[model samples]
Target: MASIRAEDLRIEFPLYHFARSMKKRLLGVASRRVKEDPQNRVVISALSDLNFTIESGERVALVGHNGAGKTTLLRTLAGIYEPVGGRLTVDGEIGCLIDPAAGMDGLSTGRDNIRLRGLYRGLDAAQIAALEADAGEFSGLGEFLDVPIHGYSAGMSIRLAFAVATAFQPQILLMDEWFSAGDADFMAKAQTRLEQLVKASEILVIATHDMDVVKRWCNRVIRLEAGRIVGDEVV
Candidate 1:
């Protein structure tokens, strides 16, 4: 039952700023404004008329240049962003690795973060407790889990985050880019786990600029430009 469908999907961001001067008002007046108001607010379209359908067991790669809305689209699919127009339907449990520290607290200990992230993912206290030990061991943080994440290095932080993020396999996996963290050995381990997750998940959507990874891991490639899908090809 895992599937995703977008029909003429559109996402826009409204930039709001106070009208400071007559010049600014005039400039805003000349430009596209939200609701045609005198206020200095302009809406920038992130995704326009995007249409696609992804069924179960598809590994899809979103390939695009910077500012091409790949991350925005992924966020939309992850239910983090609401569309401004059109329709989007996503059916399944979604796990996203959009940013390594997205739902983590640096002021808290790694163990605390594991609990918090599990809660965010809708796991109950008992479920979170059960996963805590395995997540801790998988992160390779050992006693460092008791220390505040602020004291951890970038690699250490990502290791813990990745471990927590992947502890529960999701039906739909969304990744913004390839994860690169930890030492050489740790990265190798992480990569193996990532590949396993991608394979086991019902659907995988990854946004990355690396063509080799797209070719190797994805069954389909979606090329985006200026908030629109320009090409879609089966690998």
Candidate 2:
């Protein structure tokens, strides 16, 4: 079963003060006059005292204003970021795209990225071979799949990333505002593919500012403000 639970999970990015200086925030050294007293640890609390449950087969939409920990929450679910306090539990295989280009090497060809991404996702040689075939279907990279991703245009790169990310069948899916960025024709096809993929997944947690998407795709909605959940409601 694919399930996710966050028990009072807290995520903080520890920002250490190298030197007590106003300009210490940037990499460049700051003059002593502007420096603040060096502190051991300074933490920016991204998500504080967060608790939520996403059961298998649940479709959830996370809504929030900017800087409200929506992206941070998704990262924790994808196991990309560890919580500072509390624990997060996720069951079954998980495939997520916090950033669409996370796994694809820019210098590698689209075809190479497809195989590489599959391998990175824990797929074996045979399994990657199978997904390689599907890669051509999901992505319209055309002959560019054989060329280095660096040579592709922005749209081309995004297409390749989407193809590679969706090749793996995951019990839990995490997406961050990536499903509808292309042209209308591509959007239609991609939406159809997303619907296809969503049908098979046990759970999906999406973070986006688009309320229409939340209304259409998510059965439940979570609203966050200032890194805290303000409301959890069923739509």
Best by lDDT: 1
Write model 2 residue lDDT over 110-160, tens digit each, in one string. Answer: 888888877777788988888898986678767777899899887777777
After superposition, which runs of candidate 1 have C-alpha atoms over 4 Å from their true positions? 18-40
Error of 2 at 173 (Å): 1.0
Against the reference, the lDDT scores of all candidates come to 0.86, 0.79
> What TM-score does prediction 1 earn?
0.90
Pairs clashing within candidate 1: none
Q: Residue 168 in model 1: shift from native, Å?
A: 1.7
- Give a tens-digit lDDT track for model 1, residues 1-235: 7999999998887665645474355555643322232343556678889999999999999998998999999999989899978999999989888886877888999999999988887888889998898799999999999999999998898899889878888999999884865799888988898889899999999999888889889999999988889999899
RMSD of each: 2.9, 4.8
TM-score per prediction, in order, is: 0.90, 0.88
